[model samples]
Target: MIKNILKSALNNFQAFLVTWVVIIIVNQLFIFGACFAPYCLLAALPHTFVIAVLLNYFLNAEESNKQLNSSKIDSNSDFKYTQADNHIEDNEFEETEIPFCPKCGSKMALRTAKNGAHAGNKFWGCSKYPKCKGLLNI
Candidate 1:
């Protein structure tokens, strides 16, 4: 019930107007016992304002998270992976199959082994780099 109110409030000004009216009516009838008193509506203002601010904060946060998630790589289409056997010395993956990191689940990127015995050879490394040391042979 509260969730529905919040969702509606996020999308429509009518929901806020309705919520304010209900708060004012309830305050005037139950708290003040003077249904016609104008001052009784004042008491509802703070309550309505606090609820509006809190709902706005939470709903906007949810919207931002949705946008962030939508911008992420699709995995199946965004990255191109190639056969591990076609080792190109540069940062480019040959053009066959994309592999996920074994240690973490992130997509792997083509990287060169700069200093080890396999220096100058190309392999798949975790896109996350220093944070995740997942590696694969190419």
Candidate 2:
């Protein structure tokens, strides 16, 4: 049962990765070809938009999977709980290491807010919140 679940998850991940790679290759081809004609731009735009949407969907799925797995750790089991606690501590420590925002050199933290009109996916908002309002894709 566990193997089947893992296999399914791996297959989905592989498919997602392949799709993004192909999207990148196609984008590069379009860019290098310098095809700015209306029809060409129109064709590429929809493909790019569709890929972006699908990528966002997969990202949400991955995040939910992580959360679900974390929640499944048996707190009543000493060994399991200890391992989970250690893992959580390690993640917190790693998060502290990312000092500056890759975008604007501001501090960042894990944040939750409405996923905008996009719905479903959560994002990392700048710690500066209303003032900076910078959002990072999770």
Candidate 3:
């Protein structure tokens, strides 16, 4: 527990030091517009603390997301594929055999409708999708 706390503290300190230097440089360059501005230190201190805290929060959130994903994969080590995962395999087709879009002449792609009257149904859709809006029943 102590070791983990120390490691976290060390990471935070390193992040704070980097943020402080960057904030000082930015404040000197933009706000004070001088090579060395002692007065900019006042503004940089608070800005550095805020930026460091935000950076720490976002980094921790990303680490947690990775851990969550790894844990989920580990729990499913037997490798059972869900319906969503197997959808592409179940609806396999030759890309060369699909029809061209009537509206744009672009090659049509096989797509599954998620809503409307064709919900859960497969159809040939324009590769451009929203822009072309051409579709054909499979």
Best by TM-score: 1
Please provide, for model 1 over 48-110, each residue's C-alpha lDDT reduced to its tens digit, 9 standing for 90 to 100.
Answer: 666764555465667656765777745446678877885667657445688999999999998
Model 3: pairs clashing at backbone N, Cα or C within 3 Å: none
Which residue segments of model 1 deviate by more than 4 Å? 1-94
Task: For candidate 1, give the lDDT of residue 9.
Answer: 65
What TM-score do all the candidates reach, one by one? 0.37, 0.26, 0.36
Candidate 1 TM-score over all chains jointly? 0.37
lDDT of 2 by residue, 1-138 (tens): 445444444556766556655775578576748655667666676667567446645555676677668776655346633344433554465433434565666887765555577576656667776677667776
lDDT: worst 10-residue window of model 2: 80-89
| Candidate 3 vs. true structure, TM-score | 0.36
lDDT against the true structure, each candidate? 0.72, 0.61, 0.73
Candidate 1 clashing pairs, residues 3+ apart or interchain: 81-96, 81-97, 82-96, 82-97
Candidates 2 and 3, the one with greater lDDT: 3
RMSD of each: 11.0, 19.0, 10.0
Question: In model 2, which regions exceed 4 Å deviation?
Answer: 1-32, 68-138
lDDT of 3 by residue, 33-118 (tens): 76575656775677666665565556655665687799999998999776664446634866558799999999999899999998
